[model samples]
Every structure is written in structure tokens, then in C-alpha cells.
Target: MNWLLVIVGAMVGAPLRYLTDRTVQSRHDSLFPWGTFTVNMAGCLVLGLLTGAAAAGAASSHLQLLLGTGLCGALTTYSTFSYETLRLAKEGAGRYAVANVAGSVAVGLAAAFAGAWLAG
Candidate 1:
């Protein structure tokens, strides 16, 4: 049952993530990976909210698996982020690569913290 919920959540999250990335990337023509960054930060915020809900006993274990593990797991892509950054650096966009890394980490963290605080 938990696995099914996870699958269902992933089904929604994965496509939504792709769609979001496409929409966001379509707006920008820069070397910076705005799509990937947006999805990752959004994913962090969602997961943080879920965590806070769980901490407050507002979420059940199944909900956690569905949203946190399944949705967020498929929604966020560390591998893609890493690969994009590497590709940027290899393609002579070293500054953009560094900026992506630094900005993603810093902003992602802040978003997560904010989400948790707001939710809690």
C-alpha cells in the first residue's frame, strides 16, 4: 500500500517536474540551469513542509512515504543538477556552473528552512 502510494505520487510528481522544467527553461536562454534549480528548490520546500507536518503529527507514515519519499524523490534530481553543473563547466561556462552549485545549495536550504518554519 505504501509502495503504491509512492508510485502514485511519483507518477504525478515526475511529469509535473518535467513540465515545470520545460516551462521554466523555455523562458530562459542562459547557460544557467534554471529549470533544474527551480524544481530542486521547490522539492526541498515541499519536503520540508511534509517533514514539519510529520513532526506535528499532521501527517501519517503513508503520507510521508507518498509525498516526501515518492513525490519529492522523483521531483528532485541531484544527479541531473550535478550533471548539468559538470556539463556547464566542461562547456566553458565555469562561472555559471559555480553559481548554480552555490546558489542551489544556499537557496535550497533557505527555502527548506522557510517551509518548515511556516508549516510548523
Candidate 2:
């Protein structure tokens, strides 16, 4: 049941991520991967909140698995982020690549922390 929930959550989260990426890309002309960044940040925030809620006994274990393992795992794409950064670097957008990596890591972490704190 837990695994099923996770799978369902992933199905929903992955499509949502893809759609969001496409929407942002279509709307923006910047070379920077704003879509990926936004999704990751949002995922971090949600994961933090879910974790905090779970820890506080406000959420059930199934909810945790569904949100954290499925939704967050799908939404927060480290692989995509890494690939984009590497592609940027390879394409000679070294500054953008570095900024992407640095900003995502720094801000994502902060967002997670903030979400956790707020949820708590």
C-alpha cells in the first residue's frame, strides 16, 4: 500500500514537474534553468514541511511516504539539475552554470530550513 501510494504520488509529481518546466521555459527566454530551479525549491519547501509535520505527529506515515518518497523524489530532480548545469558548462556558459549550482544549493537548503521551521 505504501509503495502504491508512492508510485501514484510519483506519477502525479513527475508530470507536474514536467509541465511546470515546459510552462516556464515557454514563457521565459533566459538561458538559466528557472523551471528546474523553481521546482527544486518548491520540492524542498514541501519536503521540509512534510517532514516537520510527520515528526510532529501531524501527518501519518503513509502521508510521509507518499509525499517525501514519491512527490518530493519526483519533483526535486537532482539529476536534471546536474545535467543542465553540466550542459551549460559544456556549452561555455560557465558563469551561468556556476551560478545555477551555487544558487540552487544555497537557496534550496534555506528554503527547506524555512519550511521545516514554519511547519514545526
Candidate 3:
């Protein structure tokens, strides 16, 4: 049952992630990896919300597995982020690479905190 839920959730999340990345990336001319950053931050915020809901006893373990483990896990891609950052650095866009790492961390944390606060 849990595995099924995970697969179901991933079915939605994976396509959504790809579409979102393409939509966001299409708007930017730079190689700052805005798409990956956006997805990561969004995933963080969602996980925070799920965590808060769990803490508040509003979300069941099954729900957590489906949404958090399944959806968020599929929607966010650490591999892509790492690859893009390294690509940027290799292409001499070292500043952009650094910015991507720092910005993603700061913004992702803040977004997660905000989501948790809102859920709480």
C-alpha cells in the first residue's frame, strides 16, 4: 500500500517537476539553474508543511509517505542540482555556481521555515 502510494504520487510529481523546470528555464537566458532552484525550494516548503502537519497530528504516516517521500522525493533532484552547479563552474561561471549553492540553501531554508510556520 505504501509503495503504491509512493508510485502514485511520483506519477504526478515527476511530470510536474519537468514541466515546471522547462517553464522556468525557458524564461531565463542565464545558466544559473533557476529551474532546479525553484523546484528544490518548493519541495522544501512542501516538506516543511508536511512536517508541520505531522507534528500537529493532522497528517498520517501514509500521507507522509505519499506526499513527502514520494512526491517531494521525485519533485526535487539533488543530482540535477549538483550536475548543473558543477557544469557552471566548469564553464567558468564560478560565480553563478557559488550563487546557486548559496542562494538555494538560504532561500530553501527560509521557504521551508515559512511553510512550517504557516502550517503550525
Q: What is the lDDT of candidate 3?
A: 0.93
- Model 2 RMSD, rounded to 1 decimal: 0.9
Q: List where candidate 3 sits over 4 angstroms from the true fold.
A: none
For every model shown, what is its TM-score relative to the native structure? 0.97, 0.96, 0.98
What are the runs in model 1 whose C-alpha is more than 4 Å off? none
- Better-scoring candidate (lDDT), 2 or 3: 3
Model 1 lDDT, full chain set: 0.93
After aligning candidate 2 to the native by TM-score, how far in Å is the CA of 49 from where it should be? 0.3
lDDT against the true structure, per candidate, is 0.93, 0.90, 0.93
Error of 2 at 90 (Å): 1.0
- Between 1 and 2, whose TM-score is larger? 1
TM-score of 3: 0.98
Worst 10-residue lDDT window for candidate 3 reads 110-119
Q: What ordering of candidates by TM-score runs from best to worst?
A: 3, 1, 2
Model 3 RMSD in angstroms: 0.6
| Backbone clashes (count) for model 3 | 0
